[model samples]
Each structure stands twice: as structure tokens, then as C-alpha cells.
Target chain A: MNEQEHIDKLMLELRRGTITIGVLSQLSSPQYGYSLVTLLDEKGIHVEPGTLYPLLRRLEKQGLLDSSWDTNEARPRKYYVLSETGKSVYEQLCVEWQSIVSSLNDLILNKGDDVNGDG
Target chain B: MEMVNRYVYAVTQRLPQSQREDIAIELRGLIEDMLEERVGDGGNNTDKMVEEVLMELGSPRTMAHKYRGSKSYLIGPELYESFILVLKIVLISVGITLVGAFAIKTVINPVEILDHFIEFIVSTVTAIPQALGWVTLGFALGEYYGGFKAGDLKLDKNWMPSMLPPIPHPKKTIKRSEPIIAIVFYVILMGMFGFSSNYFGIFRFSDGEFVGVIPFLNEAKFPEYMPFLLLLLALFIVKECLKLISGKWTMKLVVCTTVVNLVALMVVYFMITSQSFWNPHFMEGLMNAGIVEQGTEGYEIMETIWKNVTGATVIIFIVALLWDIVDGMIKVRKK
Candidate 1:
């Protein structure tokens, strides 16, 4: 593939990997599927409705999120929040993410220095 | 509103009955929220806004597939690699066998070579779809019974990197192609033995017309032992299939292989010793063809030669079977 397509594909995978953590971060307070989509979009994460809705269902099925329906509204909406287990898992994941970012930054910086040294 | 309902219907129809109602209600809420955001409080352009939102959301089938979390594939990823390996082995062996059969046919009847070539091509083309259909069916059944749940194809709660099977030593690991090729070979051999015993005979040609045919085994008696032969063939096929799925030598496989070989050897020994196994007219056909003279030294020599050949065949078969059993046991021991 051309450069743009290759980079786009890689970015898609990168974004997909982080989407779980991003969703978990948002679910601290109960949020309906559409509200969560809009919240993430405002943060420039830009998740699709189809993707976000399914992910919410899957997270709930895994007991990482607890969902309840609010029938008191104009239309019933399912609102999801983090479960107790989900909170602990999210905390662990944040620590893992920080370490990964630090290591990756070091590796990239060293590679850049090596390139300049060779030149 | 109608368009919204239709879109919701499209997505919900693909989901399970229990999930459809809940997902539909949630989808409707999401759609209305999207429309409200797009069209500010005015309801005048709602239909157009609904269409636009649905378009941005992508096709309902794609959304349904996402929500259902599994695409309906006839042969799923779990068995797909093994299926392709088995298909390749079957197709390649079948092609080679068909070519070999064509060559034999041409050698036996040079003048009718064109007819044989056409028949071979037709047979090969038909055999492909037949083999593929059966392989696909077998794998589909395997996938169904193998406890593969929808949306659970990848590693989930019960999976861990540490749970990965230990890498087998090169000698202990079975090549993916080995069992596949063996299964194909046994299938074809069984078909030939069960259906076309007459085709194994000696053919004589004279004056551009087929002359005497000395049949190897009595065709009439074949059906009497067909049930037993079929049972053995089924057992052999099962053994090969198990090997292909396991992809490594285990104690179970070793025991199975030993049992199948032993039973096959016993069957072969019994058949060879039975009077009905050989055609009664074979000697007479040889005499009629003038290959041997009646009540002469030539006839006695021919009889003695036939006896020795059958004896040698039995010995060779027994030895080969023993070798296979021993080899399997050794491999298992190494593992």
C-alpha cells in the first residue's frame, strides 16, 4: 500500500487497542451509549456508534461494566458504569500503560539519536 | 420515523430473539439522540437527518454483525487451516492418481488414448468439488462440536499466554500434511479394493481388440466381505482424521494406530487364506491365452509361481504393518 494507507491502517489498530481504556475511563460515572460516544468524540477519540454500542455490551457481559435500563425517559436507554472488578482492572491497566509509554519513548529517542550519530 | 423503525428492524433481525428487543430499544434511543444533535430542535428536516445519521453509522448488516459479534462462516477460523491443509493433500494425491490411471489406460489401449484422457479430465474436475464438499462438511462439524462460541474466537477470560501448549520436538511433531495424505491414500485405496477388484486383473490385447482378462480376485465374492472391509476403512479414516486434528503424537494416537494396523493385518491374512479370495478361472484363462500348457511342466511352474507370489505378498504386508506399529510406538516413547 501507499504511505498514507499504511499509516492509516496502523493508526486504526493503535486507536482500537486504546479504546477499551478510553471507554473504561469514561464509565466511572454512568453514561448511556450515545452520551459516551459524544463524550469520547468531544475528546477527539471519534468512536463509531456501532463499535461503541457493541463494546459496551461486551464489557457488560464480561462483568467489567454494569448496565441498567432507564425507562423513565422519552425512550429507554441503557446506562453503563464500572463494576468493582472493573475499577481495579482499570487501575492496573493505567500503570501498565504508563510504563509502556515511558519505555516506548526511550526506545524511540535512542533510535533518533542513533540515526543522527550515523549521519 | 418510518425510516428509523426500518433501520432498527434491520439491525435487530440479525440478533438473537432474546437480545433483539433490548438492542432495538437502545438503538432507537441512540438514533433519536443523534438526530436531535444534528437537527437542533426543529422537526422539519427529521427524515433527511435520520437518513444522514444512518448513512454515517454505516450499513445495518455491518452494525448487526458487530452486535452479533460473529460472522456466519461455513468453515470458521478454528478449523480453516487444517481444512486447507487436508484439501491440498486430497487434491494433490487425487490429481497424481488420476494421472497415473490415465497413463495406465493409455498404455493398455494406445488407440483409445484420447477417450481415456477425456474421461480422466472429467473425473478430475468432478472429484475436486466432491472432495471439497466432504472436507468442508467435516470441518464444519468439527467447529460445531469443538465448543467454539461466537465472539470468543480470540483469547478471553479462560485463556492465558502461559496456557499455550509446549512446543514438541521436531521428531515428535507430526507434519500437517502427513496424516492428510495418508487419509486420502487410504480412501482411494479402499474405493479401488471395494468397488473395482476386476480392474486389478491382467489384460491381454490381440489384433487391436481386447482379448483375455485374468481377474485377480473373485468379483462375486467381494460383496460377502464388503461390510467388514468398510468397517476397517471407516476405522482407518477416523484414525487419520484424529492425527490431523491433534498434529502431534500422543499415547492415544499410538494405541489407535497399533489397533488399526493389527486389525487390518488380521483381515488381510484371513482374506488371503480364504479360497474365495482368488478367481477360479485365473489359471484356465492363462491356459486359454496359451501362456501355459495344460498337464505340462509350464502349467506346474505357473501354479508354483502364483502360490509363491501370494505367500510373498502376505509376508510383505505383515512386515509393513509391524513396522508402522513399531515406528509409532518409538515416536510416542521419544515424546
Candidate 2:
């Protein structure tokens, strides 16, 4: 593939991995799909409604999210919040993410030093 | 708006019947929310806003696919590799067999060489779509009833590295296509036997028509043995299908294979030894046609040769069946 396409694919995978953690972190409070999209976007993590809605449904299906429809407004909204199981899973995921980030940071920082040392 | 309704309809139409109402309601709510948000931001031109919102949401088909959580693939990615492998094996083997059979026919009767090539081409072309249709149908059925849901594509919370299957030794691991190909081969053979027994007989082109010269097997006797033959074929097909689905050699499969083969061998033995199995008038017809001179040493030699060939064929089939049973036992033991 071309360089631009290669980078685009890599970025897509990177975004996909982070999007789940981002969604779970925010779903501690109840948020409808559109509101969740807006919240993530405001925080500089732009997720499309298309992606967010399905993910919410999937999370709910997996018992990671609890969802209920509120018909009190002019338009009904299905709001999702983190389940009891989800809270534990999200905390574990955060710990794992932190370890990965630290490991990667160390590896990346050492790259130039290793090359320079060899020279 | 009409545009909103149209888009919702488009999305819901693609979803399963059970899911349609709930998804449609959710989609309508989402769209309305999007439009409301846009209008609140002082967006003029309601039509333009609707179009923009829809565009941002992406194609209705893709949105529907996301909501449904899976694309409606007749044979999905989980089964795709096996399907393609099975298709290749079946098509290639069928093509080879057809071509090889025709090539032999051409060699025996050089005058009909052109006809043989034409026959080969026609059969191969027709067989491809037939094979593809059957294989696709098999996989589709497997997908439908086998609980191959969209959720299967995801890594669930319970997933662990330990869940991965141990890498099998090459000899122990059964290729998924092996049983599928065998099933297709047997199905085609069954179809031929059921519908075109005349094709198995000797033919001569006369008066611009291919006429049966000397029938090898008595057509009338076929009805008597057909039910037994069909039962054996069904047993074989079921065994192959079990193999395909399991994708491995197991004790149960080995036992089933052995039983089926044994039953099939008995049926074959009975048919071959039966009084009405061969056409009684075949030799008389050949002699009358002057193909074989009557009361000659050559006739006696031809009869002896034919008897020996039939005996050898029966022996070969028995040996092959025995070999398969032994091989299955060995594989099961290895496992």
C-alpha cells in the first residue's frame, strides 16, 4: 500500500483500540448514544454516532452496560451506563492500559539512545 | 421530514424481522436528536441540514449493517476459508474425473474424440455452478443453525490466550475441506446413479443419434436395488457431513465411517453377485451386431476377460473400503 494508506490504516486501528476504553470510561454515568458522541467529541475524542450506538448495544449485550429508554422527552432516548461488572472490567483495563503506556514510552525513549550508543 | 422517514425505512428494511421495530424506533430517535442539535446551532435550510446529518451518519446500508451487528454474508468469514477450499477441491476433482473419463472414451473410439471434448466442456461448465450452489447451501445452513452469531466475531470478556486451540501436528489435524469434498463427490455420484444409469452403458452413434448398443446393467433390476443403494448413499453423506462439521477425526466418526463402509460393501457385494445385476441380452446383442462372432474362441476369451474384470472391480472396492476403515482407526488412535 501507499504510505498515506498505510498510516491511515494504522491510525484507524489505534483509534479503534482506544475508542472502547474511552466509551467505557465515560459510561460510568448514564449517557444516550448521541450525548455520548458529543461528550467524547468535546473531550477531543471524536466518535461517530454510527460507531457509538452499536458499541453501546454490544456492551449492553455483553452485560458491561445497562440501558433503558426514557420516553419522557419529545424524542425517546436510550441511555446507557456502566454495569457492576463493567466497573470492575474498566478498572482492570485502565491498569493494563497504564502498564502498556509506560512500557511503550520507555521503549520509544530508548530507541535513539540505543542507536547512538552503537555508533 | 420525508428524508428522515426514508432513511429510517432504508435502515430498518435491512434488519431482521424480530429486530426491525426496536431498531427503527431507536434510529428515528437518534436522527431526530441529530436534527434538533443542528437546528439549535442556528443551521438554516432544513433540507440542507437533513442532508448533511444523513451524510455525516454515513450510508444507510452501512448504518444498518452496524446496527444489525453483522453483514448478511451467505457464508461468513468463519466458514469462508473452508467453503473456498471445499469448492476448489470439488470443482477440480470433478473436472479431472470428467476430463479423464472423456479422454479414455476418446482413446477407445477415436472417431468420437471431438464429441468427447465437447461433452467434457459442457459437463465441466454445468458442474461448476451445481457444485458451487450445493456447497454454498451447505455452509449457509451450517451458519444458520450452528449459532454462528455476530458476537462470535468479537473478543468477549471471558476470552483468554488459554482458549486458543493447541497447534496440532500436521498429520493429526484434519483439513476442513477433506470431508466437504468427499460429501460433494458422493452427492454427485448419487445423482448420476439415480438419474442417469443409461450413461453407464455402451453407446453407439447411429442415424445421427447416440443409441444404447449393449446395456451393461439391467435397467429393470435397478428398481429392486435402488432403495438399498439410496440408503447406503444417505449413510455415506451423513458421515461425510458429520466429518465436515466436526473438522476432525473422532472415535464416533471412525465408528460411523466403519459401519457405513461395511454396509456399503455388503450392498455392493450383494448387487454384483445378484442374478439380475448384469443384462442377460447384452452378449446376444453384441453378437447380433457382429461386434463378436458367435461360437468362436475370441468370444470365449472376451467373456472370460469381462468376468475377470468385474470380479477384480468388486475386489478393488472391498479393498478400498477396508483401507478407509483401517486409516480411520489409525487416525482415531493417533488422536
For every model shown, what is its TM-score relative to the native structure?
Answer: 0.78, 0.76
Q: lDDT tens string, model 1, A23-106?
A: 999999999999999899999888999899999998899999999989898888899999999999999999999999999998
lDDT (Cα atoms) of all candidates against the true structure: 0.83, 0.80
Q: Model 2, retained fraction of real contacts?
A: 0.81
Put down candidate 1 lDDT per residue, B251-299, tens digits, no spaces: 8888888888888989878977788887877888888887789899999
DockQ metric for all predictions:
0.70, 0.65
- Candidate topping TM-score: 1
Where is the poorest 10-residue window by lDDT in model 2 chain B?
B204-213
TM-score of 1: 0.78
True contacts kept of 1: 0.81
User: Pick by lDDT: which candidate is best?
Assistant: 1
* Colliding pairs, model 2: none
Error of 1 at B279 (Å): 2.0
List runs of model 2 lying over 4 Å from the truth: A114-119, B70-72, B76-78, B97-126, B147-196, B199-212, B223-258, B292-335
